[model samples]
Target chain A: MAEEKIRVLIAKPGLDGHDRGAKVVARALRDAGMEVIYTGLRQTPEMIAEAALQEDVDVVGLSILSGAHMALLPKTVQLLREKGLDHVLVVAGGIIPDEDVPKLKEAGIAEVFGPGTSTQTIVEYIRNKVAEIRRSRKNA
Target chain B: MFDKEALEKIKERQEQWEETTLQQWLARLPERDELFRNLSDMPIARLYTPADIPDFDYLEELGFPGEYPFTRGIHATMYRGRLWTMRMFSGYGSAEETNERFKYLLKHGETGLSVAFDTPTLYGYDTDDPMAEGEFGKCGVAVSSLADMEILFDGIPLDKVTTSMTINAPAAILWAMYLVVAEKRGIPWTKIGGTIQNDILKEYIAQKEFVFPPKPSMRLIVDTFEFGAKYVPKWNTISISGYHIREAGATAVQELAFTLYDGFEYVKAGIERGLDVDEFAPRLSFFFNAHNDFFEEIAKFRAARRIWAREMRNRFGAKDPRSWWLRFHTQTAGCTLTAQQPENNIVRVAIQALAAVLGGTQSLHTNSMDEALALPSELAVRIALRTQQIIAHETGVVNTIDPLGGSYYVEYLTRKMEEAAYEYFRKIDAMGGMIAAIEKGFPQKEIADAAYRYQKEIDEKKRIIVGVNEYVSDEPITIPIHKIDPEGERRHRERLARVRRERDNERVRQCLERLRNAAQDERENLMPYILDCVRAYATLGEMMKVLREVFGEYREPIII
Candidate 1:
């Protein structure tokens, strides 16, 4: 039997006010045959996690151009975990410094894609990560 | 400069030359791509000459500087008379810390002040608010009430310094705080010279910092227009900004077309409110991006001035030449600054700043090199300021007036840009003005498409951003990201709490209630009421909350 399509919720968590990357990445993921839901700009971390839980998505991709990732992103991941969504695959993409990538990954993000990370790279990562999550769940 | 017969002869020769010389050159070189487009993705010609502009009437099309069309510049002498204001956007941490940064820039010969508010202030929330958790002093300074604004300009004289606040969603509230500051200094509103980045239209289009819905948000803008015309004559009530639009991944033509359309829509709204064109148009300034392409950027500025002047004079029927002027501030494109090899961005910034000066920007802000890593450090900010000073002092380009004005390439691109903008105008008009089109998600879709295409180009390596997509580096980033001490938020909360505790509670309540009533009335001008709120030391978040209750918050229509 064929597998079900992956669902991803993309959100802009905080007041960065730059949404070009968010919209582009959302479209790229949507075009890749994933069911993508994009919440518009100025979303709080709680809003993102609640949407993620409500939508029951396999992935939560955050796009922030503002340098508030250190504070805002962790809050988002923590909220998701608090809601018992630790099994969800999470990723971040924007103008994050290389140093911050480790910290974000440590904060439960699966991957951090900086500027110039190709859409295809992201699509494949999500597909692979979702497949891994489903396989692990089946084994458990 | 070319007559009809001369132009015709040149055209015939150009046709023959294209058929022969161009064909041979293309067969050998094959050109980069058949598209051959600019950053805005507008097609470019192989070669431009007199033949391209057949009826090129110099007097009518390209007028003298500070003249009717003002195609060359708004000032006759251009930079020779006075250099563009070397203003840098500065803010971080708490109000006191940002104030120190402000003083540092002023001490280093920065000509003007451009305030950058933190996300909470921008979104009209107080620092201590639950919604503002974990987001204090990250991007810019935190100003919750009049007390913070007071501390922000503690040593800086309100009358002497012209501060440009980069607050939009709550611009009226912030501007009122400035007005109250000036009033405290015993200065009349007429004496103050500054700008409120009160351009809500662009917020809906690009910035995404808008609060209320379109109709009420526009009413707030028109209120400022009416209020500024009467009291704050020297102030630029609205800086119709395209910097964010370009930064949002719009092409140069898209930026020009959309920004100008936003400006025109503001004019139409003002006129609909029974205000005369000449009364407020003179004070309507513009803000544009100085992107990487030097020539294209210059052409965009030149084309913008011409379009605005013609529209004001011919379409709006303004008798005052001042009404036709399109004075603008140019900021080096922040998106163009590469995170990899941050030092190389200095060169990029110098080139972009030169383009802005050459294009005759009235004011300029050069982005700091380390901005890609974080908000600029003190050392990085100094280097950025010196970059502008060196251009003004050492570079002799400013000595000449519009040095690139008459170049065949520049003129052709200027004409092409103007035509593209007009085409967009027609589309927008058919869409029943900017607001209607916005609701229908026209401009938003266009910006998204352009952004995607540009990013795709960069990813595919078709477009080369020096340090980003090419000449890659693996060096460790040593640049210091501006650290906001966690104590800043605690202190910010304490100060906001103190302001709430100390201020006259009854007066604040009365002022807020009045504002709420005025907001409900469609005909009421909100500026005065907002000023009353400010004078009573009401917080930005409080006022925004009242307006939200009355006007309702804006939820952007999904474009993708």
Candidate 2:
């Protein structure tokens, strides 16, 4: 297959410093044959968005556990949009509450995977989103 | 308790029974899985018997409560006389908001207050600092100066309550602010009883909240040890913690070994600083995580007491009986709480809290159900506190000291944990102690490997985290999670600005300069200088800035 591996950037966008899930997901994505860039802990939204654009990745995964998701995630999504990287499939994972899932979705995050979500589910979702982005771009 | 001949006869009989009775049962029924194991993948037997721990000596290993090698307990009466302090860790948003929450917890029957500082405070930054942007009051209560500390504890009498500030890196400054607040309240430093989580080694190894280099950080910690021993005698100067290590995904044995090693390192630092082992050793306390593995957690606690007691007495030559005590505060594992089916966390907290209590924790903090989502709402915190209360009052396990002390399985597991810890200790000693081991990423690699294995277990369905991988739920979380106001940052910044404007600038500058001098000096205790800055109403950011200029900021070497 001549298809390039789908690039994904896994970033910790807050001061939570909990990267276990982030690292696990990154490993899973890498094992699933995706190119992944992990920005370490205490990343600001600008740092994440800048890295996402610079890496030119297809998916940006935000891992936050400091209970600052509502404040941080939305800003991250908005920053990505401002950088014209809206097509960068924005996915989030961590200790995100259920009520905030819809809010995160509304903020332009494509999917919010809370705790207990298998990497397979996350991988499948990212593949689907990346495929959708590619198809749309090809049509355009 | 069995005689040697009887023990030999019983072993032979048990072997015969296993070959016949157990084999017959196994032939009829398939075991649930190929192998039974704990979270660490340690092979666990289906049943434990005297054969598992044949040479178990209760008097030698697990002496009575309040005795040497206190595998049973540190307290004589245990919960029969009084329950473990329900010290709920609570804080979020501004100082005023956290103060209200403190009063709320107190009114609801919380015995002690554990202050959870926000990320900014933890990293030694004021709320208004550019580095603190978008992070004010996000994780815990944000207090930048003595003004905020005073407001945070407003109406909460300093002498009446014990507060545990979960602050590292800038522990001295934060603690000094605390002492100055109490002083302003007319309470002497000696009268203040609480703890500062001045455990920086674990910060480098696990939490990653470290500010200064290891040498300077150790110096600052020793300063607190000397000062606490001389001035604030009742205060637990350092809560050598394994809570974060476990939360960072360490197995029970790693948590036990690594935490004890950190404690031993502190004892070494104190001795090297020319302080008597007994003077500060008694004031040294410990904090451990009560994770889900019930029996294993209980075993870990028992092993911890034994290891600490032996090390303190035999190795360190601490003569005071109090110095030999491994008094600890336990918080149920927050990492175990699932955001999915949030209410299930309540049950999980209760079980872990029960384990901590059974393990003889001097104090306990039960994680609220909504913690995975947010800090915790009022209702969630009450339930968490009630979980502890119910375990203490309703559960009759606390009626007797070391209620599970005599269980064959528990004893077996405790011995296993102790042996595992000794193995790690040997490995660490070979690597030139905990600091060198940490520099080489020993504990970090261990925790990462354990975390990876644990995650793999969950992914492969080998390990079942009730609401997580096993009893999966898609139920919408209906529980209210506490959301820090987005405006909290603006308000906090304004308050910090006001503090900076109102405080005497000359005194603040002088105090910071003095602190800088002391931080640069190998001989001077930095606590007094830090306290002077706190008295001058210097902000945490400013004081930390001076020290950062003097001691240099620490950049953690990346671990692959």
Candidate 3:
């Protein structure tokens, strides 16, 4: 049987036109032997979640630069839950303040990568998370 | 005098670590090649020296400020005579909402106004248009007609303050709308001062916000130059921009080289249109990105001025000194801001803004701290503006012109940057200029390759991003984020509907028909006809649709 490649969707939510980080992350993920899909700038949360569901990726990374995280992040998490995509790991990045990480975690975000975070750390985190999911599913 | 023994001791220690010379090392590592790195990579050498720029000529390469080959600055006083304009780029929701923001920015010590239009408005769409669904007032303010334009400006006097509009593709139509509004306010076109980011080359290169293909876009730009020279004498017809290019992941050198290449292309286009080079050249301005590398960013700006001056005077045969001067506006790199440590963005923006000031920007926009989170809250914007203010007043660097000009490091880097830029220009020329290169996927590929290399280095731990790799942060975020009103879109659509129901439909139809006719006719200037449509209260979508039918939409040739 052919090895099933890990697929990831990197998306930018809302009016934020800042996508350098997202593009870099996408490129890094692709290089790390994962199949990456990048949703270009100015995507809505609805659009992002829908893309995640349609693409059926192992991981979904939401890059938010417009500071609408509190309002937008909850909507995406809720959408994912409603879509029965709780198994798909959700990670948020961009200029998120230190104090909001707990709030985001509470909202079901798996991890938060701030500025200066290395691409390797993110890739490794996804790899570990995906393996954990696989182990849990096999036991079930 | 006694350092010889110390140097010998240091050399012995260095030899212990690595005994081979550079040449021997290169021989062993034949795969290692040095020249130009691809677009996305963090530059291999963070700091350059005299060895990097050996053939530096002060008189020929970097002449004094306000002189020929103006590498140091455009003006003698630069910021001393007048500090760079603190222009806040503001817009959101409807015309009325943006108008309020404009006034608020001006009241809060903003020197100039830079308008940001909603995607629909940018693409010349009316809020009520079906294609404009869900994007009416999310990104920027929507201005569909002269009525909207008038409401957008309201009590603001166009004659007194300069306004820069970040719009392209449908720039002529939007400019026409501004002119009609100015005319209504009894302000002659000559009295209005501002810049139009009418750079379509960059649209093809990085932004991907283009409407027409290259040839027609160039024609439209030339038409604006001709029209602006005749009427809006104080206005800058085109802002050759590298801000978008940098934001799209280009290095400082690529941003400098590509932006200047675009500017040169526009000049060439203008000459072909039979306009005297000096007549329109003085009005041409630039916009750049102030990224993380402080000294490198400064060197890029200095190199840009020198290269522009030499090319305009020597290559283009322009006689006017004003034509040689390269004035620019800068915005701190929004890409550099981190969402994890949102408060850190304030420090980052401060450093970037200072780099811009030292580099001699005519205008500047400091990104708000909460930018990476959402549209900047009012409080966040105020802090961003204050960043510029503190630099202007508290920082004494502005007291001296080009304070870092003669520094060994700055001078060397400036030359290196200029040389690297020329090398890129030569390559682009070989590929048949920017248009031909772009078509062949040259620039796109170059950028992508560089981006890939940079990412690889970060992954391998060759590059150390301060907060990212080495320093671990387990802390959560606590910054306040700005929230967009959910009702904003509904309110905008209702207002657009009301305007359509109330406006003179017949007049709108006639004006739009004229615009369409003008667009179809190659010889006719589209400005006057567009002005008429604006005066008729024709929605942006209506006018754009007509032109879109005439010009057809441009589809980018994806390279990567």
Residue B445 of model 1: what lDDT? Answer: 90
Where does model 3 exceed 4 Å of error? Answer: A7-22, A37-118, A121-140, B1-56, B455-461, B470-476
Candidate 3's C-alpha lDDT? Answer: 0.82
- TM-score ranking, high to low: 1, 2, 3
Instruction: Please tell me the TM-score of chain B in candidate 3 relative to the true structure's chain B.
Output: 0.91
Residues B88-187 of candidate 3 have per-residue lDDT tens digits of 9888877777888888889989999999887767766677665455566666787777767888889998999899999998898888888888998789
Question: Which of the two, 1 or 3, has more DockQ?
Answer: 1
lDDT score at residue B441, model 2, on the 0-100 scale: 87
Kept native contacts, as fractions per model, are 0.49, 0.47, 0.26
Q: lDDT, candidate 2, residue A23?
A: 76
As a TM-score, model 3 comes out at 0.84
Q: How many backbone clashes does every candidate have?
A: 0, 0, 28
**Following a full C-alpha superposition, what root-mean-square deviation does model 3 have from the true structure?**
6.1
Cα deviation in Å at residue B479, candidate 2?
Answer: 2.4
lDDT of 2 by residue, B151-268 (tens): 8999998898999999989998888998888888789988889999999999988888888889999999999999999999999999999999998889999999999999999999
Show model 2 residue runs off by greater than 4 Å. A53-56, A77-87, A135-140, B485-490
User: DockQ (Cα-based) per candidate?
Assistant: 0.62, 0.52, 0.22
